[model samples]
Target: MRIVFILVLAVGVGLAGFAVSIAKDRFDQYQTALAEQRNAILPTTQVVVVNRQVRYGETLTEDDVSLIRWPAEHVPFGAFTSIEELFPENDELRTVVRIMEQDEPVLLAKVTAPGEDAGVASRLEEGMRALALRVDVSSGVSGFLRPGDRVDIYWTGTGRSGEGVTRLIRANVQLIAVDQIADEQRNNPTIARTITVTARPEDVAALTQAQSTGSLTLALVGVGDITESETVEVSTSELLGDVEIIAEGPEVCTVRNRRGADVIITQVPCVN
Candidate 1:
């Protein structure tokens, strides 16, 4: 009876040991999988982002911004990784040139250079000039024109034939300011007496001439619109859809005969 009891105890102990071995193997596999998952995570870097909504012309300060861990591979171009790079010691503070929302990453394009004001000049690209055109409620897209919006300019005046004509003068012209406001976040539809646009030097000269001799109208372009406007012109007659009818004279046949050095011609009825 004692031997039987001893054998039973030995069997129970071996079964317990086998169960422990299985659990240990499963725990080791789980630990290996967890380490691999941690290694597979993308590396991150600190990026400067706005802490609150910032509008154009507003000054950007250290308090208004914070650092966040952003994916290193997906960091935006011109992003400032450190606060020191964005605000150098003894340098003038930077100003916002474009609207930036909360938590938005600060980019070089959205802010002006240090000490630079948020003006139309900051919005103009190199080799581009800003020109202001006179506009009313009617010619300014019903006062819905805003900064950073694109527009198509039209000129209406008398042509060389002394007839009224309307022609598309420019297409996809970028507006930098509406009246005195340069903020792109302005949504109020106030009638702007003048709107400013940035264009090349030659384009500015042409637009000046057109504005001087004719009325300029602004046509708002749709957001993200990349289609270019084709050459378009409408004359007074064309607008009325009037077609000119030319009077056709009766068809006549002519016969010519040469008699020595003299030639004789006779007109006769035409035969089909």
Candidate 2:
């Protein structure tokens, strides 16, 4: 029994040692292979585009870029071989691509405009704000307004607050543009397609209120004097004191003819 136990113990110890040795060998081999691969990748110069425009359908290639900016810094050098990876697959964007040529950056701008007029957008200079306003003509409702045209903005009233009561407190908001001049000889006088107005701070509220209260009404202002003043608050008494008011006095009923007439006649009692 003792011999058998000793033999079993020896076999167990030998097996455990063998397993540890195998594991150590595999670990060393893996570390050596990983170091060699890392060294090999570090020495090669990847041909990458330094700075160029990335456009749609542009394939990524190793020759597109020279010196990888930084794998984890400027751009992920290892993941993307070309500029196409920077943009979404279906995105319509123009990206600037860069590539190193003799250790120098060369830039490029790619275009992704689809059937869009480049001239119209390019002509719009800096510091100029663009606003889109709806315009209508006699032909029908039209929004095909070009960059240049004169128009008047008007609001319409629904007249819902009884016939006697005023439906609109204030109606008719004029043109919205401030820097507008009309050459009537060049354009039509009676009709306007869309009225774009340049308005001051005070006028902006008036126009905004018009949009809420009533339908906008467009009235053309020619080369005449355009004067606008700040509104002053005044009571009804102050506004209408000078105006004539014809009001009936208090009712005093008196008997008229024998035929019984319901007439509103006034008379003074006779003193004997």
Candidate 3:
């Protein structure tokens, strides 16, 4: 009985030693793997990134951005490294050129100048001209029209037929400014006395002449709407339905001449 008890104790001790040896080997392997992973990682650098969603034309402030440690190997080209690089001496011109998502690296190409305002030039494309039009409550789409909205412009006045007519003078004009503000970043409703739009140089001439001859009104297009331009006009008949607008032109004169017993009336052009 004593020999059997000793044998059992020795077996228990042997099993304990084996378990410890196995645990030590696993711990060493874990430490070696952790060291290898640390050596393989590339160095990181600090780069400016938009901490929140930013809209186009919005002025940049310190609160709108943050610095994040970015992998040096994958750091974006033209990325700003510090706040001084973005707004030097507290310049307000470093506005957004395009919509920026949260955590997006703020690249130099995505912002305007440090002291520049989001003016008319930033909103216009090449070969485009910015034209301002006087608008009332009705002509401006009841003040719902905003910057970056597309509209169809209409002119209401006398037509070449010597009759009143309302026709579409311009289609797909992009509104860049409402009142004096350009490329506004908010979605709030505003009533602007005047609005500016970007137009092709060729369309500017027609818009200028139309405003002088008649009144120009805007029709807002649906957001994300993409449609082909079609001819849109409203005559008195079209507006009232089943009504005809008669154009008065040169008057015709009737002459009655008596021959024998019959009187003949002839139509002739009226002289001044």
Query: Best candidate, lDDT-wise?
Result: 1
Query: What lDDT tens digits, residue by residue, belong to model 3 across residues 1-272?
Result: 99999999999999999999999999999999999999998899999999899877788898999999999989899899898888787555488866789999998767777776566786677789999999988998888888889999999998887778899888888888898765456577787899999988889899999999999988999888899679888876567778657999877799999999999999988888
Of candidate 2, the 10-residue stretch with the lowest lDDT total is: 163-172
Give all TM-scores, in the order shown: 0.80, 0.25, 0.59
Question: After superposition on all CA atoms, how large is the RMSD of candidate 2?
Answer: 18.9
| Backbone Cα, N, C clashes tallied per candidate | 0, 38, 1
Ranking by lDDT: 1, 3, 2
Model 2: per-residue lDDT, tens digit, 109-209? 22223322222232233443333234456321233222233334544544444221112222223332322322112233433444444444555666567
Off by over 4 Å in 3: 1-48, 52-93, 97-101, 107-110, 238-272
RMSD of each: 10.6, 18.9, 9.6
Q: Can you write out model 1's per-residue Cα lDDT over 221-250, one digit (the tens) per residue?
A: 999899989999999999988787999998
Candidate 1 structure, TM-score to reference: 0.80
Q: Which candidate number has the best TM-score? A: 1
Error of 2 at 182 (Å): 16
* Ranking 1 against 3 by TM-score, winner: 1
